[model samples]
Target: MKNRSLRIFLKIALSTMLLTCIRPAPAPLPVILNSPVGETITAADITFSWQAQQPAAGYIIQVASDSNFRKIVVEETVSTASANLHLKTDGRYWWRVRARNESNIWGFWSEAAFFILQRFRVVGALKTQGYPHDLAILGNRLFIADGQAGLAIYDISIPEQPRLQGKYLDSLNVAWGVKARDSLVFLAYGYKELVIINAVRPESLKITGVLEYPQPGYGYALALRDSWVYIAAGAQFIAVDISQPAYPNLRFQYYYPRNCRGIAIENAYACVACEQLGIAVWKLDTFPPRQTETFDTDGNARGVDCRDGFITVADGRNGVIFLQQDQAGHLTELAALELNGYASAVTIEDTLVFVACGSGGVAVVNCADRANPFLIATITSPYAYKVGAIPGTDYFFVLDRDLGIVTVKKEF
Candidate 1:
């Protein structure tokens, strides 16, 4: 009877011990931290707080350099609701909390939380559709010339988030280039000539003037300066006097050896990039205009821009050619960098040059030294046709034949 009673007592004791072991220990204190935060937190030193599973004797907080809290940087025992932490540098930090009993047994670590510190500037990108050819910014608005679909206006007051204001679809041919001054918006439509519209009210853009080209297959490019408007027609460059915005008159036409694809004017000289003749510098100061000098290239030059004392040209076959401009306004070939594919357009700002290639994507070149240009980075789209850069923005706008318009932020 005594043995039986002893065996029963042993079984009951074992069962009670087994049940006590199976019951989960009180959960450790939980620490919740905020997230989706900035890299650099400039607020007053952060205060970390936590809630215990129950009224405890005290709490232990361990801040570690790693997510696992293996390398503890700070271990503190506090009996308050908050702990003051002063972080000096920027990096990812891990933290956890623990509760202790009067018997000096420490509880398990709570869930880990992390935070990061950053210092670099953040850049963003935006995308659009329909051949976005040229971008013209006026005040807080950005105007895009959408080929075939007409003109599209976007409110770029907020550079990061551009909103479409309105779109006008009144033309058949594609709108190639757009230039805005005051309340006037000049759109270059292939074969349709120049369409002038009043853009004061972007929501209600109305055609105010239409200047027709004398011949077909003309009016591919347009540039405006003061009261003069320069148009690049096939094999010829036409100048129009826009002193009277409502009535535009053909000032004159300068015949070149090959088709004029692009034109840019500075001072008294007009630089024209010709497909067959290379680049022709005309003396615009002359009454009828005379070709003063010409710089020949290996391939057809499609785009041209002048900055400081150097002229940059984009050849369809030869990547980019740097030409030095003399005091006489003459161009001398300095250096040429060969690109992967057919180069169509080029824009130079600060220390970077953006090249738009047909199927080769966009090539970014570091042109700090005009004598020795170096290719820095190349970002390609499926079929990038053209590229444009805003003067003061690091944002690059690309026109893709298949993807319409894609905006990329320059990380470098």
Candidate 2:
């Protein structure tokens, strides 16, 4: 009887050990941060979000100034997967999240994610005369379109202090747009004329030639190529022959039902931003360019710039827009990012795009990946009208209607 009892006890102990060895462990939960991850943000208000885990009752989020989370700035526990918070400081930050299971056991903390805020800084700024509308940089000189105050010239050899070198006031009308090269400068004079100036001697700028459009016309913007000047007039798009600056003549003129506000040229293609009509494109290989296609946009198309096969536009309230051009000179929308303020103009420099957002500020975008463009930084202003980038440098200039010329630099 004693041997049988001992045998039963041994069998029961062996069965218990076998069941414990075969049983499986619970699976680990995953917590992943979504947006603002590895991105540079300009706004103070941001939403922190993470993926929801199954069987999770709640989540804990923490933000820190250091990667090791030694200096924790925020720590909160919530039932939801997202939290809206305001960050008052501008710098690099690290964040992590973890979940609590229904059994009251906390999961492992997520791997730390990092991001940057306000990576740009105001390096210099100067007040200017008149309501500055647009700007052009030629070598060391800066030309400004100062509305009815005329055109103002400055020597930006020192970007911090743009000393006034010369200015021309058109008492009759306003200087709406400007473009300059070696010795010549083109001006869109109010609604009736395109004025050519001999800027070789800026202090004594003389109007060398003036092409007057018929009655009731608006000359809003202009673009310069080889020896031709393309004009975006309210209801018309005109191309003028500037081979002879002294006597400019019209080479091609076409009228559109929608108003044309801006113009840009790439290789043999010319694109005009036609307000509500979107974009109007022309093939310029022929003596008289022909309109090939028209594209519609979601917002008011105000300004544009194009290079290689990529096109960028500042769509009024819609912000910055990206486009692609095919071999046939056809254009298609790739992506559109809505930003703060009213986008009035855009300048494309290599992989970067600078947009002038009136009142909202100036936005710098990274377009290295055309299909996935994102904002790098934003420099706020009272009224930003136009933006221009200095070649070979990360420095860009913004023409503010209320504040004049503001210089911004991208910090590493």
Model 1, residue 182: displacement in angstroms? 1.7
Prediction 2 TM-score vs. true: 0.75
lDDT, each prediction: 0.73, 0.84
Candidate 2 clashing pairs, residues 3+ apart or interchain: none
Model 1 clash pairs? Answer: 39-118, 148-174
Error of 2 at 404 (Å): 0.6
The lDDT of model 1 is 0.73
Error of 1 at 223 (Å): 1.7
Q: After superposition, how far is residue 216 of candidate 1 from its true place, in Å?
A: 3.8
Q: Write the per-residue lDDT of candidate 1 for residues 1-412, one digit (tens) a residue.
A: 9999999999999999999887754544454433322233433255677664465667777777688778876788887645777543334677777776555556777677776543212343455556666667776777887777778888765666678888777656778777889988887777766778888787887888778765744666677876877777666787878888777787787777657877777777777888998888877776677778898889989888777768888899888999988878888888899998888778777877778877887777778888888775567577676666655666656777776656666543
> Which 10 consecutive positions of candidate 1 have the poorest summed lDDT?
35-44
